[model samples]
Target: MSETVPNTTAPGRRSGGRVHRLALAGTLATVLGVSLVNGVTPAGAAEAPLSQSGKATASSSERGDLSAAAAIDGKENTRWSSAFSDPQWLQVDLGASKAIKKIVLKWENAYATAFTIQTSSGGGQWKTIHTTTAGKGGVQTLNVSATGRYVRLNTTRRSSQYGVSLWEFEVYGTGSGTATPRPSATPTTTPTTIPTKPAPTTATPPASGTNLPKGPVPPGAVRVAEFLAECPYTHRLPDDPIVMPGLSGGSHMHSFFGNTSTNADSDIKSLLKGGTTCSPKADLSSYWVPTLYSDDKPVEPTGTTFYYLGEGIKDELMAQTRPLPLGLRIVAGNAKATGVNDPTSSSRWSCLHAGEVGSSKNFVNCPAGKMLESYLDFPHCWNGKDLDSPDHKSHMSYPVNGACPASHPVIVPKLRQVLRYPVSGDPARFRLSSGPGYTMHADFFNAWPEAEMERRVRDCIRPIVKCGAGGTP
Candidate 1:
C-alpha cells in the first residue's frame, strides 16, 4: 500500500524555491542549543544513495557550465560551484517525498565553514536537521532526522574566499513515502499519480502439472516469482559488474533497486563483499534500469511490484532450471532504439486502471489518475558453461516456440520487471537518461550468496513454485 504526505507550503513561497530561508532561520533559533555531535550517526552500515537520483539546483551558479545539478551527478570531478558569497545553498529534489536519514558532502577545497542541512516539502518552508559552524574541507558525513521531498545544504559561511564548491552531495536513506496526489489528476497526461492497485496479497502459483522431475529437467522449462520494492529511485551507475566495472558512471542514467550502494565504485568482487538494502537483507546483488525523465526532470516510483517469470519448457523441464550464478550479469532491452519501434524491445506498456495491456511496441494511454507501467521480460535461457560472454549478451537467449535453442540450453528463472512510473500518458515528455524511450536498458548483477541461491532455485524455482527471500510462495 502507498502512504501520502501533504504538500502544503508556508504562505508566500512558491513550490521549489529558496525564498523561505528567513523562516527556516527563525526556526533554527529553538534548536541552537542542540549539539552538532548529537546529529552524527555511525556510518559503518551501508545505505542507499539518495542524492544521485534527485534533481539538483543551487542559489547561484558561478558559471553556466558549473550548474547546481553537478553536485549530485555522481562525478567527483564535476562540481556545483556557487557564486562567491555567503548564504549560498545547493539542494536536490528527491523526485518524490522520502524519509531521509543521512547526507554526505564531498567538498572541493572551497567548502563551507558554517552550514545547516535542511529539508522541505514542496521546496517552500524548510526545517533544519543538522548544523555545523566549524567545517572541514574534505568530507562531512552527517546523520540527520528529516523527511521531505527536498534536501538542501544552506551555507552561511564559506571556508575559502573563492566560493562554496562541492565535488559531490550524497543523500542516503530508505526511499520510502508517497507524494500527495494532485486533485483532478489523470493517469494519461499528468506525471505524478501513484498506482491504485495493491499488489496481490498471496502468491499465484504456477499451473498444475508444470513441475518437471525432481532433478534437472529438460532445457525448456520456465519459472516465475513476484516481489515488491518501495521507492526505487535513479542513480548514475549501472551495477552490472561485467558490463560496468570500477565505479565509472554508466553510459546512461539508471533507476536502481535492491542493493543501495550500486553507485559506489564497485564490481562483482566489491558487491559480494558488501551488504544490501533489500528487505531480506540477503540479496546483495543490485538491479538497475535506465532512468525515466519526464519534462527534463527525474520521476521516481513510489513502490514497484516485479514479476519474475520465464517462458519455454513445461513444468517437467522447469525442474532442471539452475540458480543464477554468482557474478552473473545480464543486460535486457535496447538502450538505443525507441521502445515502441525496436523489434528487440521486451518492454510492454500499460496502465493500472485501464484494465488492458498495450502492444510491446506502443506506449500505453491511461485515463486520468492512472499510472504508466512498463513490463520488461529478460531472456530465460542461459548457457550452462559460462556466467558471462564476451558480448555481454550471448550467454542468454529467449525461448523460440516454447523451446530453448542449442546455444542457450540451460533454463533459469526469467525476470519480468514491472516498473510503474508516476507519469501517465504524454510520451513526448518522457525520456530515459540514455536518450528517448527506445534507449531504455536494464542491468542485473548476481549478488546472491552461492549456497542460498542454489537452495532456493532447487527447492522453489525449479519446482515452478512462487518464492521470496525465505522460501515458498
Candidate 2:
C-alpha cells in the first residue's frame, strides 16, 4: 500500500461563525422521525451551533468523534453501545456556528448506500441536503457549503450484501480567514506499493516526526510484512467463488456450499477489534494487490499498496457449486502445527486441506458405506470437532481424539491478514485538526475511554511509529 503523509498544512482561515452539524440517523425509529419531522434549513443560511443539552454534542473543529452525542444523535445500537450491531447512525456537531465549505464522509466498508445529509439550525428543523451512492471500499467525499448547528446523515439503504461499520468523518471550512496552510509536501505522484517480505534494513524513519503519518515507513513501525505474519486471525469468509475484478454486478452467491466472498473489505478492518484497520487495504486486496505486483515485489516505493480485489475462479460460477471434480485449492500456508496426531497443521501447505468425513449422510456423493471428503461440514464444527460435543470443552482444551473430524470443518481465520498492499506512490496528504495521534487525514482508530485509547496508542501505534524510524522495538 502507498505511504500516506498526514497533512501538516492547515487550511486558510475563513471568518464569520457559520453553523454546521453532522447527524447520524440509523434505522432508529425515534431518531429518524425526529430528524425528518424537524425539516432541515436550506444550505448556506446562517445557523447556530447546538446546545450541549441537545441530543448531539459539539466540537470546535468538525473532526468527528463517534462517541460524541452530536455524532450519533439518532442512531441506536451503534458501535459505541454495549449492544452494538451492524447499521448504526451518526451526526456531526460543529462546536459553534461557522460557514462550512466541504464535508468528507468515510465508511468502515461499503455498509451504507443512498445516504442523505441534511442541515438544521435548531434540532427540530431540517432540510434535504446531500445524497450519495456507496462503493465496497475506500472513502467518499461530498462537497457542500451550508451553515447550521446540526447536520444529519440518514441511510436510505444499508448494503445487505455486507453488514455495517464505520471509521471516521471530517468536515473542512472554506479558507477565507483563520485556517492557514502549512507547507506540506505536495500529494505524491505515485501510489504506495505492498511489500511481501520484511522491509530492507537500511530504510530510515520518515524525516517528519513519526507522530505525523508520512507514508508507509513511520518512525518505529515494523514493516507491513512483519505485522501480517504476527497478527492474530480475527475472522473469515465462506469458501465462495471470487468476484471477478471487472464484473460490475452481484453480491457473493453462496451456490458453492462452502465457498464465500472476500469482496467486502470490512472483514479485514475488524481485526483491530475496536480500532480501524492498520491501513485502508483491510479488504480489496484481491484486485489491488494483483495489479501492483510483479513476482511479489512492488512496482512503487511509497504508495502502490494493493487492495483486496474481487475474487475469480477462471471458470463458470456454478463450477464451485458441488464437490470438486478435481482436487481444489488446499491453502495451508498459515498452519501452526503438524502430524496426524498434532492438532495444528503445518503452515507450509498453501491450499485447502481435506480428509474423510466420518459419515456419508453429511455428503451427497459418499454413501454411508464409503469414506468421503467434502468441503461442507456437520453442525457446530470448530477445527473439525463438534463444538457442542461433551468432549469438546473449550477453545483452550484439545479434544480427547487428537484430530478433528473432517465433517466438522473449520477455516483458519484469514480475513484480517493484509494479503497485499494496494497503492504505490508518495504518501498522500491527510488533513487533520486534532486527536492525540491523528493530526492529519490518515487511517485512524475510533477512540475508546481515555485509558483504553492511551493503551492502544502506546502498545500499537507507537511501536509502528518506532519501526518506521529504523529503531529497535
TM-scores of all predicted structures: 0.50, 0.24
| Candidate 2 lDDT trough over 10 residues, lowest sum | 347-356
How good is model 1 by TM-score? 0.50
Per-model lDDT: 0.57, 0.25
Model 2: what TM-score? 0.24
Clashes of each: 19, 123
- Candidate 2's residue-wise lDDT over 1-473, tens digit each? 00110011111111011111222331132233432223443444422122211223222111111123212222211221101223344555443444565554534433466667777766478876687665442345565778765566665565544333333344444322221111111111111121122212111211222242222323212211111111112223222112222232332221110112233332223322333222322221221111122233322112111111001111111111111101111111111222323322211100011111111111122222222111110111133222122211121111112222344232111111121122212222111011110110111111123343232224323222211111122
- Report the lDDT of model 1 for residue 36: 26
Provide the RMSD of all predictions against the true structure, rounded to 1 decimal.
Answer: 20.3, 23.3
List model 1 lDDT by residue over 313-342, tens digit each.
454455666666777777777665644655
- Where in model 2 is the C-alpha error above 4 Å? 1-87, 133-137, 161-163, 174-473
